[model samples]
Target: MGFTGMEAQKDEDLVTDLTGIHHVGSYARIDNLINFENNSASQLLLVGQRRITIDDVHDSDNGPLRVSISAIETPLFDKKNQMIKAYSNEIVAALREIVKMNPLFKEHMQYYSQRIDIHNPYILADFAASVTTGDGEELQSVLEELDCESRLKKALELLTKEMELSRVQQSIKEQVEEKQRILEFIAVSKLLGKVQGRIICLVGPPGVGKTSIGKSIARSLNREFYRFSVGGLSDVAEIKGHRRTYIGAMPGKVIQCLKTTQSSNPLILIDEIDKLGRGYQGDPASALLELLDPSQNTSFVDHYLDVPVDLSRVLFVCTANVTDTIPGPLLDRMELIRLSGYDGPEKVAIANQYLVPKALEKSGLKEGSEHVPPTLSLTEGSIEDLVKRYCREAGVRNLEQHIEKIFRKVALEVVENLANTSHEDQHNFTISPDKLHKYVGQPRFTSYVYLERMYDKLQPGVVMGLAWTAMGGSSLYIETTTVQTKGGKGSLVTTGQMGSVMEESTKIAHTFARHKLEQVLEPDNAFFEADLHLHVPEGATPKDGPSAGCTMVTALLSLALDK
Candidate 1:
């Protein structure tokens, strides 16, 4: 029965027939293939143009017969060639999985493509090595291939041997610049006489380089810069951090400076130190003592950090318009440098070295123009006139502003002229003093008044006196004239906002004048019995101090001597 079933199944095998036709070019027979019921023996067969398979043959089955069977066409190509498309799809899937597992491979692939395009084998090797071992040896190997092995090795050797050399060079350069900057500060401080710090107190009439020199110092030192105007700073906490007990406790100016500079050793400028206010809370100047003192600043403690931070390395610089307002202890710790008013010669140099070039650039003058020469090509005579007449300040701050104004006017003319001419032929304009008035308008000062004021105004009972103040020394005229007598008894009248000391000096002068007159002209006569009056000019100015002592005496003597 099994043999019969197998034969029936083989007869219905269409796939077997087609496969047999492709493989052998003939049909196959099922009875010769296998016995299905016995289930042990199996066989394959070809009958004509068909194929067949069978299983389980037995002797009772009446010879071999087909049972279960299956068949398919034999492809004309080999199995390897037939599965090529499926194999390629599997390969693609595997590559995508690898990319997902390591994203760096994708980046490496892109880099490799670029490297191959450029024929940079070194870069390719380095990239590959970086991906694999993550070491720089591959990069070094690439360098060797590029013929840079010796140079790189030498550079690395030098770098190791002289690591501190570069640091020393930088330090030396910083020191040189610091010296130069301090010198400038010293000059200004000397002019002002006494100031707040070694960095120099640039105190003069406004517009001087008082603030600028500080900025210049920071630039010269290559340091991070910050400016806090203590013009009205009343709280000491503004400089020294508040205690940690307080909410929102923050670091003071010094700590903030340290954070900003990143380096402990930065040139810090405290501007307007003299302007710090004395308040009920505390004095900022007292707080500055810890920050500025070189001896005690090694372990400076901030309230916020509550840790001892080293601030000895930092260079503290301070500037002020007035030194008298600074605390005595704080002032004593500083090496005061004073900046005075710029003289004519100095102004000329500043103009030539700094201001002129700046002005020309600002005026839109071509960088390499030969025709449009420096406007400040003014002679020494003219520059001197400008200094004395136009820009008469203790410092060149106003002078800089005036120069800027001059350039602004020149810029308009330059623009207009360039607009009218071809670019190639636009280098024919020059600015002279004659054209100066046209651009800068009329001269702001008269040369005549400055020249005339230089000489002393000599008159009866008037003597020239030199007086020293924060503004420097100036020649003062002490004038004394007889006024109408009031009573027979000698009395003294004083003016010119005389201080108590100055008023006392006037009384002394009267006594001295009376004694001299009595001895020289009227022996045994009473000059003290007559009324006398003494005064100083500029009555609105409140003048005080003992420096006027000799002036008052000399004026009284001159009056009594009738010289």
Candidate 2:
């Protein structure tokens, strides 16, 4: 035990010696002899001159160890001197904010700070270093620096860093308070798991009013509405947030939503969760795992905010074209609600109730003080014609746009003849079924849905085929016939905007037909001697896929057997 204690004491003594000595050959004055003439416990002013270096250390017989030193001179060029002056001025400016934070330093610094020489930039730097609250080692290192410019630069760096760290600390404090307030609100309401079932996911095709429905829901609940689009969002930072190390980094969508809505509990519509793209930065889907997952999200932490944000109070409603496109784990956490595209009745109702009135008000097409004077009404027959000729889509977006167009045209006429007693023309500006063609040009399309079909009667080489798609089911015709014959080297031809998979299926079907034909054909029959062409009609639709495999095979067999 005694030996260990002796060794520890020796190590401590060696460290003290090493800490005082640096490459600059300087000494740290433990007690100032020159400044002893005036001893005021309130403050001690140590004026800096030049950097002094120790030459030798000697032990006195009765008193204490003494050091002999020499002054080291360093001459600065005009550029470096100016740089030092600039940096020192910045340090002085930064100290104002720093001193306000530290009272002990402020009280003593207030007196000498005002009288300090700003002209001697090196002296100003020393003034700040001496009065500032910092690590003793760092202060001594600055005191040891001989180069005036380097010393000032290092002091400025330290001051700037200290101020920045203080700001971040303050920011974190405010965020913590904000988080606490939100948590308290959540605690009182305690709506964590209770509202997850109310999490409505509106999944349907684009322009189907999924986003509009989310806004309506918010309005009904008397809550603030905010929409966050995660479509094509590849960066995980977009969901989580970039770290503070990144310049101009900020909180992710969830935290940003809270800031934007200005309420702890706002209805947030997360749009296009399915269309999130993956990239090298990170998988946004994985980041959203913690965001949407209710159990894990009670304490959601964004990298930029670096705090556990309580997203539980903020209701999240997601919208997507298809649920299958959403990540499995993410989809599993929410209540999936499938919203089909509007039918003809639903589309017409939406246009009549919501769209026409809104567009008329916006276009200033009114007779009285109120902008919506019910002056313009789209006749039901005209609406039906518009639906059939202009738009027959599953969504009402196109229908709404067309309605907007009619109101816009009428608005222009109202403005043009405002001075000309326009009551006659404005009141009779109703859009009738016949007048729709006058305003929007001739009927863009007939009330006929195009379908792929073969000739009325079954031909020897043609077969009626059926296919399914995202748009719906459709029937098509596959036609095959003999095209060329030479040297018995039969070649097959395929056409009709077929993709790679479709082309390969046609080849497979053709091979299967030949195999079957060879078994039934007499050895002398020239059934496989001619080149044949296989074609699918309605080339405009760009048909492709293995869905047509069976139809292609049946057509080949019909051609081979001449049935």
Candidate 3:
């Protein structure tokens, strides 16, 4: 028979299962009744007793029968050891996965696993129960659990959740650190005031590499590039986005540029600032002051976003044909870099190095195989003649176009020759100085086209003068004529769409002529008796500046004295 007992000083402290020791209710079965075997003289115990005294179990005959327990407890230490080992191993495995998920816990993994191994289920349960959320609620619901297995399962569940949370926290930390570093970089850049505060304005004529320079700067800095034209942008909403209340509301060009490049520090090219227009809507030039200003762009607020965006790190590059039309306030914020047009030698060099190869490739005339000989070539003299005779503007855009045109014609000729002649008899094509006109049609300019003709048909009232424009310098012919009037008093008149500056120059020339030539001219001469009409050729072109004063005086004096 199995027997179990525990000693307690008070009956109130006793708690045990009495199902095996109790007799079956309402039945007297030999196995169900506890057979004392007459060992105890007193048998006063009854079934289902709620309370009992120690004296009730005392034997009167044998004086507390010698109850020597053969074996008090049969310890299944192996099973208990197995259970403890299994629980500790599972806990270690979970903790190891935790370390793998987040390496920040790796350093303490061994120490934590050892502590868990020493205390086993008890310590493991405590660890899980201690894992409370920010609001002080337990992470796992294992409270009041007396079974070790149940507690271990709850602890594992809690560990898995905590590990996931640790990974999430780690990711968030890294992102925050990266954002912090970027902010610090921006702050340092702003403080240094090198490229951050600077806004560059590329001032030059058309096709002078202003936009190309902006692209090169972006490439060199390894920053994203974006370009937009403000040439005729009149609405302020184009710079700063439209409000959401509008039908087709959107962010301004600055915001759009940032979005298009997907970078906060992209190189933005605001093209044709000088051509920015002002209409009834609003002034875009005035709006650009905030976008291009370093001191205020840090907190640039868009009407659509209605939130300040930090644009201190963005590099702004603006282009303009000239600065004269740009608003003063907007112009004051930019640093001007002048890009002059290419000269003759410069054009020739550019054509040889860049334009020729590009044109050849585009026309499918360049040899594809490196071992193959070049099929098309241009002599330096021919290119020099092309530059002097045609494409005489300051920029190489027209030069490049002319080269491409030549390559196209050469390509056609080469194809024709190849179709007719045998491969062995084929020869390289070259355009010498003499053959330039055959392909390019005819020379647009000549060295003595104007001056030679002027000298050949020299007249008393006509003279040659030089004038400078954005396209480069050119010669102009000033002509003067006298129209006899009924009265001797005379008036001076000028034509040729001259600007105020040129008109003033004409007046100055007239005054100088009257003072110096009053004695030289006779009283009855047209200088005193007729209206002097001064005219410059190319009447459609609007000419300005006082540089032509001397030429005007020379023409007027020649007409008055018929010199």
Each candidate's clash count? 26, 0, 1
Candidate maximizing TM-score: 3
Cα displacement (angstroms), candidate 1, residue 562, comes to 2.5
Off by over 4 Å in 3: 1-198, 245-248, 367-375, 421-428, 448-453, 456-461, 481-488, 499-501, 519-527, 545-547, 558-563
- lDDT for model 3: 0.70
lDDT by residue (1-563, candidate 1, tens digit) is 11111223444533332222211122334546665677877775432222333432233344322334444243232334423334333333433443455465577567445634312222222233333321233333322332222323333333222223233333333435444556555446447543323333445445556566566655544456766677889888888789989998899888898888687667677787888888998988888877777667778888888899887556667777777788898888776655566566777788877777787677665467744534424445555656766776666767777777766766666666656666626453454555556645677665535333423556656877765665544555677766644345667677788789878878777777676677677653434454556767767877777777777778877766667
TM-score of 1: 0.57
lDDT of each: 0.58, 0.70, 0.70
lDDT of 2 by residue, 1-563 (tens): 00011223443533223233442433233334333334543333334445666567676665533656677676554655567667866887888887665445577677776766656766667776766545555776776676778878778766766665454333323435332432343334444434453345667666776786666546534469998888999999988988999898988887888888899878889888889999999999998878777677889988987878888767778888776678888887766655556666677777888887777777776446433335467899888778777876667878888888888887776555564664645556667998987677777675434432346588888988886544334577889888765456567888888889899998888888788888988755665778888888878778777877788878878877888
Count of clashes in candidate 3: 1
Give the distance in Å from residue 438's predicted Cα in candidate 3 to where it truly belongs. Answer: 3.3
Superposed Cα deviation of residue 266, candidate 1 (Å)? 0.7
Q: Pick the winner on TM-score between candidates 1 and 2.
A: 1
Q: Report the error of model 3 at residue 439, Å.
A: 2.6
RMSD in Å for model 3: 27.2
The Cα error of candidate 1 at residue 86, in Å, is 65
Instruction: State candidate 2's TM-score.
Output: 0.55
TM-score quality measure for candidate 3: 0.60
Query: On TM-score, who's better, 2 or 3?
Result: 3
